[model samples]
Target: MFFLSLVVLDPLVVVLVGLVRREGIGLAGAVMALDLCGNWWGNWHWLRDDPSQLLRLLPLTLFGVFVVASTLPLHRVVARTTARSETALPSA
Candidate 1:
């Protein structure tokens, strides 16, 4: 249950950050797909060892980790970019 929650929440965090930063829908979509794919590939070896036990949960777990990973960086990038844009804008 904890793991399942992590899996579900992590990606949501990423999407939230992306939306806050106003990232294009296309880029966000790509990021999500890549995040999921990367997680699956990274964990495939471990999951294979106990295919029956972990296979069912592997996709969700991997996705969660991916989202968590993706979100952290996105948050930082968005913050920095937002700052830069604000600084660049002319004074009112």
Candidate 2:
């Protein structure tokens, strides 16, 4: 349940990341995954179209982890850069 929300949440986060960073081919895949999951919960037609149900489980979860793996490290990099930049600045 928590993970589901996190996965759904990440596309939004990464959309901002992509916009700020100006890149999104892979993150766009995450959005598609969100669409699959969203559609599944939204109606019965989704299952009739994609009966395998892989969308809600393996792929989306994997993409979510991938998104987190890709972004969390980037966050650390940004934080480290910001800290270094701040320390290098002289006090006013």
Candidate 3:
């Protein structure tokens, strides 16, 4: 049940807000870490039993890593763009 909340929170709270704000990227990265931990914890038993099942979950793991790895670069780009836009705005 708690894992389900993490799943919902990741997209709705992180992804949607991140689309509108650069800080969202950092939030998304944090949420992704939590999600990865939750998934690993939830699947530990099955993974321990079969081992090969890790293959099936590999893509999810990779994606989480990608999100975490890219967050800083992506956030910097967004922040730079926003700063440029704000500065470019003429005084009203």
Candidate 4:
């Protein structure tokens, strides 16, 4: 059920990214983090049997690494943007 939901949720996040909303970016980071953990958990047996299998999944692993590396910087940018926009609005 969880994996099945990701099928729809993943694409929805892509669309959310298109909107460039802070929530979307946050969600994307979260989804990708979950995805990486799920993939590793599912593949652990094969990876244990043949450590070389890591080579086959290196791209995915690298992408996961990149997402992990970039998420913090991206989050800060979104936060700053949100803060700026909020401050720009006139007081009620």
For model 4, the superposed segments whose C-alpha errors exceed 4 Å read 86-92
Candidate 1, position 56, lDDT: 66
Tens-place lDDT per residue, model 3, 1-92, is 76768767766656555476876887788888988888899899999999999997899999999999998998888889989999999999
Inter-residue clash pairs, candidate 1: none
Best by TM-score: 3
What residue runs in model 2 are displaced by over 4 Å at the alpha carbon?
Answer: 1-40, 43-45, 48-63
Tens digit per residue, CA lDDT, model 1, 15-78: 7655675454334545566556666677678777867756665676676566555755766777
Ranking by TM-score: 3, 4, 1, 2
> Model 3 lDDT vs. the true structure?
0.84
Q: Which has the better TM-score: candidate 2, or candidate 3?
A: 3
For residues 1-92, write the lDDT of model 4, one tens digit per residue. Answer: 66898999899888987876777777888888888888888889999999998886788878988976787788789789889989999999
Q: What lDDT does the true structure give each of the candidates?
A: 0.63, 0.60, 0.84, 0.84
Write the candidate numbers in order of decreasing lDDT: 3, 4, 1, 2
In Å, residue 3's CA in model 3 sits off its true spot by: 2.2
Structural similarity to truth (TM-score) of each candidate: 0.47, 0.41, 0.84, 0.81
RMSD of 2: 7.8
Worst 10 residues of 3 by lDDT: 11-20
- Summing lDDT over every window of 10 consecutive residues in candidate 2, give the lowest-scoring window: 20-29
